[model samples]
Target: MKNIVAVNDKKQLASFIDFPHDLYKNDSNYVPELFIAQQDMLTPGKHPFHEHSTLQLFLAYEGDQIVGRIAAIQNNNHNKINKTTEGHFGFFDCINDQETAQLLVDAAAKWLKERNMTSMIGPVNFSTNDICALLIEGFDGPPVAMMPYNAPYYQQLLENTGLAKKVDLRAYKFIAGDYNDRSLKLTEAIRERLKRNNIIIRKINMNDFWNEVVKVREVYNGAWDHNTGFVPATDKEFHYLAKDLKMIVDPDFIYVAEQNGKMVGISLSIPDINQALIKIKRGRLLPFGIFKLLWYKRKIKGLRIMALGVLDGYRKMGIEACLYGLTIKTFQEKKYDYAEASWTLEHNTMVNSAIEQINGKLYRKYRIFEKSI
Candidate 1:
């Protein structure tokens, strides 16, 4: 008998967090998320997202055995900002049973509808700013840093649940030597031009991390403002993410374009610690798990070209090329093997085309789903 229990208390919430650990226990590609970090994000008073939006967690059980889990989210800010009453379901997991999936989603839908949301669109626990998409493709390997992963059967289960396809997001991949040598050869010229303008690329000053992040936040929010359904990350959310990434951030790959005095552009590449975490069992880091993390972190070779942004007036004039080049240059200097420039909108021709210029090939796709209530 499968029962849905609301994760209403400390015990239930802990179970909600732990369900994925058990589910992916034997899966070698699974990365154990940092427990303390997960705790802070899910805790109401601890996370800023909870101040404007809300989430309800549900765990499915078959007579004391945890079978599955889901997070029902009411993003009031999204509705208010977009003027669309769309609720979200995220943190989804299941046992590949149709009934179990249905019950979990049904409960999420019911909870959202009670809040007067007219339709449902997700797998988005909070928003796109976080790891919100389902792994519809690229499951042959472990997920990259901060990216989501799931079994391929999840697509069948979601479709069976009537969560129709909404939009597909893609991740473009590049092998170290395979990506065009043009970006490689032009690195010198690009740096020369930027240097003439007093714009140099350098690692973030870790001693001044907060002030540095504040400046980057301005550019980050401004850069992605035009993307569909993008909500500028709140201070807490951005800081939360920055804190997590800081652990793996390579100073050389975190480049800032400063001219004279003002910060104009930025590009960030994180070592794909998913390479290491893929070995972490169910995201746990305790009881001997920490050794795997401590030892294997430096062995990672893959990188994720996670962010590149320039201010509006500075979009053209080769700033994007410089940022991209600096990142690849750093990759070469550090001897990283491959990278993924990901989650580009299908309609974003400019960036997609730019990535292609560097020989990035479309290798993975993730879809965001929506349906009218």
Candidate 2:
């Protein structure tokens, strides 16, 4: 008999987190997420997301065997910011069987409906600020750090369960030797022009990271406010994220554009730690896993251009190209393999054009789905 059970105990939650390892055991492209991180994110009182939002995880079973898992999420901040009573489903995984998938989705939907959510949208783990979307294309390699990945049939499974495409998020790849240096050549001239306007681009100051994070937060909130499904992260949330990113951030890969010392644009990237993470069994960072992570950290050869944004008034000032140029320049100097500028909204033609101008190839695609509850 097939049954769906709410994850109410530590054992069940562990099962929920470990299911994907079993499901994708044979898949070469699968990268295991850090188990400790996943645990904190899912546990109430552990993650800041749970301080303002709620999520319930469910596991599907065929007799004694686990078949699937999903999380029904009620993001109070997202709904309150967007003024929409929509829920979300995330951490979704299942077998190829439609019956198992349907049961898992139904359980999540029913939970959200009970919370008075009129609609559902996701694959969003908690919110857009985190890992969201299902990989629908570019299954040729493993995902970078903090990106989501899944089997190809995940698209069909979710569609058959009644979710329809809400948007496609694009990931553009820049090969080390494949890109044009027009942006690089133009950067000096752009800086000269910007200097006439008293604007300058420089690397982030690690000594004063807290203050810099505040300035970047201002730019981040202002620049991305108009994006689809975006909500300004609360102070606590942003701080929490900044604290996490600080551990892995490379100063050379993070640049800020400022005018008279006031930041107006920022670009942030991180080494693709998934290169090391793929070798960590079950995402544990203890009992030898920590050594692998630390040892391999210096060996990572790729980066993820996680974010690049400029405040509204600052657009078209060549800040974009300068940021890209600086980032790509560092990548070349360091002899990195490639960089990924990712999760751009499909309709964002301006940013897309900038990426394409530098020979960035649309190598991966991810999708977010929605359905009426």
Candidate 3:
């Protein structure tokens, strides 16, 4: 018989975080998440997310052996802003067993129901602003930084638990030196026209990082307000995320659009630190693991075009193409192998078309599943 237990203490939390390492130990494509980061993210008062939301971790076990894990999340900001009593489930991992999957799902559902939620939607760790979704396609390789990965059978297991597809998110791949340079060729002309409107595209000012982060955060929150499951991140949440990204960010890959000194658009790409993290066994970064990370980071040759956004009124002014063109130009100069622009909503045709214009091939697809309680 399987038993589901709430993770309430440090020991149980440690088990919950470490379970996936053992579950995917033999899988070549599995990249372990950092243990310390996982600890910080789950602990109350550590992550800014806990300031306004609540999450309960649950572990499924057969006697004393752990078999699966999940987090039932209640995001108050999302509910308050969207006017829906929907809950989310995330950080899911399990053996390829339908019974174990159901146990975990049931546990999460029960927790949500207790909170009076009418429906549940996830694989979303907390919200769309965080690492979310399940890898339903493109399992041939490891995930990039801040992306999710799962075994192929995960789809079947989740479906068996009565979850239906809520939406599909897309990831497009661009092989450096191979993508169409139409944007690059046209960027100069677009900039000239934008100058007529007093708009200019420029790289982020790293000298004043905090102030720059504030500007970009404004654009991010304003630009993505209409997206599926979108929620405006609090200042704490945005800065918390920015602090982490600062470590792996390439300044040249971050661009902003300004209209007479007012921020209107922003784009950011980060080095794929997962390439380094993959070599750090079990995602430890102390003792010998730190050396592995420092050594491997220099050799990382891939990038993830993590964010690109323009304020609603600023859209269609070629700012998008300029940001992408500048990024691609740097990618070629650095001689990186590939870059992935990812997790775009499947129904977002305008953004998808822009990526496609640069010859970004659709390669990976992720899905968020939902079910009524």
Tell me which of candidates 1 and 3 scores higher on lDDT.
3
| Candidate 1 global lDDT | 0.84
Report the poorest 10 consecutive residues by lDDT, candidate 1: 275-284
Per-candidate local distance difference test: 0.84, 0.93, 0.94
Question: Model 1: what TM-score?
Answer: 0.94
Which 10 consecutive residues of model 3 have the lowest summed lDDT?
Answer: 176-185
Off by over 4 Å in 2: none
| Superposed Cα RMSD, model 1 | 1.7
* Candidate 3 colliding pairs: none
Model 3 lDDT tens row, 1-373: 8999999999999999999999999988889999999999999999999999999999999989999999999999999999999999999999999999999999999999999998999999999999999999999999999999999999999999999999999999999777899898888899899989999999999999999999998999999999989999999999989898888898988999999999999988999999999998888888899999989999999999999999988888888988898888889889999999987999999999999988999999999999999
Best candidate, lDDT: 3
Q: Where does candidate 1 stray beyond 4 Å?
A: 195-198
For model 2, residues 254-300, the per-residue Cα lDDT tens digits are 99999998999999999998999999999999899999998998899
